[model samples]
Target: MADDAQGATTPVLPPERRTAGQEHVPGNVLVSIGALLLGMLLAALDQTIVSTALPTIVSDLGGLEHLSWVVTAYMLAATAATPLWGKLGDQYGRKRLFQAAIVIFLIGSALCGLAQNMPELIGFRALQGLGGGGLMVLSMAIVGDLVPPRDRGRYQGLFGAVFGATSVLGPLLGGLFTEHLSWRWVFYINLPVGAVALVVIATVLRLPPKRTRHVIDYLGTFLIASVATCLVLVASLGGTTWDWGSPQIIGLAVLGAVLTVVFVMVERRAAEPVLPLKLFRIRTFTLSAVISFIVGFAMFGAMTFLPTFLQVVHGISPTMSGVHMLPMVIGLLLASTASGQIVSRTGRWKVFPIAGTGVTALGLLLLAHLDEHSSTTEMSGFFFVFGLGLGLVMQVLVLIVQNAVGYEDLGVATSGATFFRSIGASFGVAVFGSVFSNRLADQLTDAFRGVRLPSGVSADSLAADPRGIQSLPSSLRPDVLHAYASAITDVFLYAAPVAVVGFVLAWFLREDRLRASVTTPDVTETLASNPVERTSYDEVCRALSVLGSREGRREIYRTITERAGYDLRPATSWLLLRIKRYGSVEPAVLAERGPVPLTVIIEAARQVEERHLATRAGLDLSLTPQGEEVAERLSRAREDSLAQLLGDWWGPDRPTDLVQLVKELNGELCGSEREQPYDGGPAQRFA
Candidate 1:
């Protein structure tokens, strides 16, 4: 019957059940865990490792002139490649794609270390980012493949910790390499780490392959990358390299804006779009990714300025500035590790990110109080506090993203999240970094005028080196000091509003948990194509939940699905109520009256499926010749077990030990016996 209200075209599931691969799938899941974790390590490592080395990279390559481009190149490459990697993972199997990414990253890292100039480094870094981007997106997408979301609690937490550890470790290693070894060694470091990750992933990650048709959105990718590169270039370089009104800068900015509009139009019409606009219909997925972008923007934007502020405003050396970042890093490590373990134990994770974002915003707000007079101790407290917030949210959101979508969509869904965050971070660094520099220059000029400084001093030169201000002739030093102090303070104050934007976005964030993994791609539509009655336990649950919207109906459906997969009919009303609510019970010694317990069906199913009995479809409750014999034997055993359990609770005079007596009693009462009367008199009915 077509159910018009439910849009009755709803497909009924067939009798066959589903799984990740097939029966005894846990072994496959266990094997997959390593590959997923390896991918996670690769993804998380890319973000943090590059972040830590950027300053040293700027110094060694003499690319402060093109400093923002270094990070932008990676962001552009990763964001552009994110969707493609996802589609490929879905088509070719997750394990193979993950291993390839690790190998590719290793190759890129090796080349990155050999680069002689900024352009070469940028090109190599872009390649590395393309590979690293796959790491995060695919790791999460594979998790969707292996684990049913309902049981994904522990894995999500483990993933979160993997990401957190990478973030904290990136800076620590970056500082160590830059201080004690050649700056080029920072890029060199990924080679060894990536080799190890690759080895672990290759030996353990196994997968099943079935190819599906998919087309790459090459034009869309090109347009998106071009727009991002141009926009970021203009945002990061405007007023510094080229005046805001200059023809070259204006032309690039306008071109980027126009390309962005074209990308949207092309995506809308493409046969196989990189980012399907339809995915936004999923409320949880859409909202969570938005929040992720906001968080990434604030986190990436702030980290850039924090070190600069320490060095420029507080007169701290580069190594010392890195050291000062320790409290925040430590806070992130402890919070993320602890929260992940806790989420695994409790199977509850949504609240942590929500709360953490709120607190993080508060910490950023407090940190905004920094000025030249702000003590290092005060700064440490703020960093640690904010780091605590970061630790709570970052990795958890990715888990949430993975959980909200289906398995086939996992690659694209996860990459979509990574893409948004990448885009947001690029936007943040370009915009905020530029604003900070502009304010610093402006303050330096104003301060010099108030104190009558010599006209020859360049404000930028003074601002660039804290010592440069103090080294100035005494007649000009006081004004230089005031300008440096005020400029740095203005940057922090300006940064406050950006943190507020993140805080508000957090308020609307959705925290969805994992659901059951879809064994088949597009199960909803595929099953609907042959809409009929249910076949599997999951199908039954889905049907009842959707069709029976009245209060308590879902509970009935769920109860039946869990206890009896198919043979789910009730006996006595008492037993029926139990099965409808609390689910099946074990065979017992003393269910002497009332009805049969649910497990009778379980035993029946086991016997029938194992060929001890025959339960052919559409047989109208008639057992086959062999089934008749098996059912009789089962009835006898069930009677005995029930008698034993009910020995004290039921009638003391009832036969409690003999299987024959139970068989006779059930045969007489159930109309199975040839000699049974139509009904027992009132008192016997109770028995």
Candidate 2:
């Protein structure tokens, strides 16, 4: 995080941590970038790896009937536990939890690979998912800890590919195992990969414990987890063994609904609620969460059927099916990485999510029309477009939500977002599964109307079973194939409408310009409004949303100065963002990973002081009454500019466009330079 703009020295954290601006380290930035990237990879991999294996797993274990449960179990376990992990990580530390997740996932992976049956496999997959949940969340939370949102795009880009890539790789590996080896190898693969990630994280990642003392909200956790589990189960079971109208299904739905209401009530009274209810107050966070659920709905609805269509209808081997999955992976990687760079350079994020979702909706339209006879190229094209949309929205939403809330609430915001997406995915699977199964069963009954059926074939067995497609006789197989293909197409047709809903949600995302100079003090002031919450290296080179600016650290400093009264309390995180962003303007990102050294910031400050441009007394970060007074003055000045600049842009919600405009202006060569000097007049002494 670069505290200095284009080599111009400044403590960027606002409110309290405004630096009298002393402290510096000449080197120690490159290492931090590496760590962030690693953390990101872990999350994306977990998400993608299981997609291709479902078919092989279902067929091999004689559990095609319970295939949905495999995916559902993972989604439920991971999402239900997300808030708990994020809150604990914030309370204790990020790196600690990040490492812990890797270990947990490793164990679960081994168990999944070793399972003797589908029932056993599902249990292990749930364990793996519990650990996997922490990977995505902790990485995002840690990025908030060290990098500011404005310049996070570049680093986000580097790590963003993993999200799309994992989606592709997961299928490919699953296919490989299903075709050439056992499908269980898909889970086993995590062992070696997790080991490599663990090594990088252990050596390179670092985070100090927060000084605050707070208790974990046990009751709130139980309520949230119970509600989440119930919703997930209802979604997973609705169309399969249980009817939407069945008492079992309805009761699950009702119980989950009631539990969710109870969770809201309990949180209001808890001292340290797992969910930061206050984050919903922010327009960005609210909109982002809504849209995230839509994205998940659209994505899962389509993905849930692709493998089965390939195996059951097209007769493609699982491994070849994985090969066919590459188009989407390529598309996701291209869009996500490109979008990340675009956002970083421009500091505009709103448009990406909107456009991404819109694109996804269009892709779904194409898939909805697909049949088994469609050419491979045509199918791949649909997947590619779908993948691109997913890529654009995935990381961007996390960054947007994190930026919308206070530092302490970073974990809560991320966890909340993740939980919703997980829930949405489960919901999509359930709703569409019911629709597909009903359609397929009807089609099957009609196709076989005049033909004599085999001895054990029964409608009750077919409707109650997830594996009915695999049981048709060769004479009736063609009919079943046609039904399966039509059912899948129908599922995507419904998914298209779900995506359209997300597009509507995206339409409302509010775009805000990032402040070029954020003092640490500013984030602390956020604590004044939000008393609620808020690590990692891995595979420490890919996942932390790395920003190339120290501005957030400056804001954090400002917040501290405003709340607790201090300017530029010693920290190494500020250097990470600043150096990562402008350091390229200065030099390449360092290869090592960790927080930038505090002395580096001090020395950089010393360099400024020696140059004789800025003075110390007014500029230095300290806890005296005068510092607080200065903070009030600075806050008002910044707010005044917000009014002046934002006043002219009145019309539709141009969130993405607005952010881009601000990012460009803050950089050295562009837009807002002429007016920038207006706000900092005597504020130059601090520089």
Candidate 3:
């Protein structure tokens, strides 16, 4: 009796919490998503908004030497803090932690706008990055919590759209603010939008306390943060601030390597590790991380030189260059949105990253052939293909990792994937910067060979100020422009092979069917329900949808019969369980509940009665004493079959909620038509 009571209580969650983000509270979903997107936009915008404002900032602050740190500090802090924030959200609660991130970001943003010098600006930006990291990862984790994998595509796609939008808009907005207002407005602009998002989230995004003992992994945090900071500094500073072989660069590299080794050891021993090493064992998790990293490496690495190419070779203004980037932006938005809808509807996704990487390589190869004579239209076309490839790879890769893990690992898993991509982006920028700078210098030296009469002008001066290339003598200007174009082509040539590596890695991705619910689809309804309202009954119907086709029914039958070690048709077992449920119900009533035909019901009854498993008088049906024992065993058998099918929950024992979820999911097998496979086979791949 005590055990039974404990079982009953286990299903009841502390108190039902409702939020717009939770599926159960569906009304507030749009508002909640809007708020989440607002936060995402702020983080993404910050990464780019400072780009066009940098010159103005440098002039005002008089710190040209420390210019790169403006961006590097943010990236370094954001990358290091990502995993830690995720782990904390898992322990303390995502809602409060997310809100805290917003506040921190706001504080940093406000301070950034007020900074009088480069050091203060970099410090405030780092502070902002701490919060920005949390905002990004937590928003994604929240989506995973709210939406099932199958339905997540559209939301993730929207996020991709936001990212793409910000990429183009950030520079334009930054330039406008710097020219028309103050350079500081670039940071200050986040204030009103962030305040609105904060208010919306606080009001609409409620979640139950999922707190536990906060065994903060202080050592792991310190080690990983040190490693991230050191690596980012090396990437941002090497070959520019210091030579690649300089002691400063070498020291940072050695420090990063040692810190990484210590981080791994610390994680192995830490309770509630920041990034669980066990996740690496999952093929999807590990593979997705690699693919994400490579995508970032190739994409960010090569794309860094695009604006310079346009300004020097094509003579486009900064604003015009931003405008000319439209082709890539349009392609990305279309590909991401379309692919998401297709995946949500069809549930087949493995083909995307494979094809995306292939296209990315193709795009880079074509770009390697670009020269001084390349038309703007031709350049736009290449960018479109590259953008499409990135679009297809980015959102879906996260979905794959999220689908592979259990619920408890969602936050860490999402954050870890983002972290790898960020690290890749940092390294890509550095490596590509070094390659492009060296090649450009070599090309200019050759172009300027044996030339004279350009008084007070040098190759280095033209390289720094691309605008000055046009202002030089027409005879010399063409040589400089051609040299700039040739060097950029070499950068693309170098980046193409990296993308091919991603293509090869994508082939190993194991395609698993996306799950229909945030948690596994089970029949157990954890919450108390009104049988009359039939919410549980609806869930059962949804689960039955999985078994609507002949293939699904066959799998279930095969599973059950294999356990029985004999051909035990579902009719007999189902009838016995039904009899137990209704307590001697009329035959018509039993048939109605099962939606069983009269003839099939009669046949099952006769077979059970013959075996002394059930008996019937007139229209009424009852389980015989022997039938009760047989039914109990069959029920346990059903549970075992379900456990095998649904995948295991993450605890010592399966929760009663899962039992209820599975039971609720087993709604009467409505004869719904099986959905046919989508005939459009990887159209997004071609885009």
Off by over 4 Å in 3: 1-34, 48-72, 90-96, 110-123, 139-184, 199-210, 282-284, 336-351, 399-411, 444-475, 507-687
Q: Give model 1 RMSD, 1 decimal.
A: 15.3
C-alpha TM-scores of all predictions? 0.63, 0.67, 0.67
Residue by residue across 1-687, what tens digits does model 2's lDDT show?
333223322124322331121112112434655654554555455555566777666656665555666776777677666666766786677778888988888899899889888889889888987787777567655654454333344444444455545556667777777678777777777777678778866775554444334677878878877886786677667766787799999999899889989999988888877776887889888887788777776667566668878777788887888788778767766776677557656778888888888889888888887886889989999989998888777657765765565434554675567556766776776566667767777776777788887788765454444356567777777776777788778888878877778778887887776432211111111101011123111111121112223233455434433543334432322322232222111101121122234455565445433433223444332222443344344334333332233333312553453444334323321111111211123332212
Q: What digit string (tens of lDDT, one per residue) describes model 3 on residues 183-291?
A: 8899999999999999999888765445545688878877877886787678767876689899999999999999899899999999868678999999999988888
lDDT for residue 220 in candidate 1, whole number 0-100: 88
The positional error of residue 337 in candidate 1, measured at the CA in angstroms, is 8.1
Candidate 3 residue-wise lDDT at 483: 87
TM-score of 1: 0.63
Report how far residue 268 has shifted in candidate 3, in Å. Answer: 1.0
Candidate 1 vs candidate 3: which has greater lDDT?
A: 3
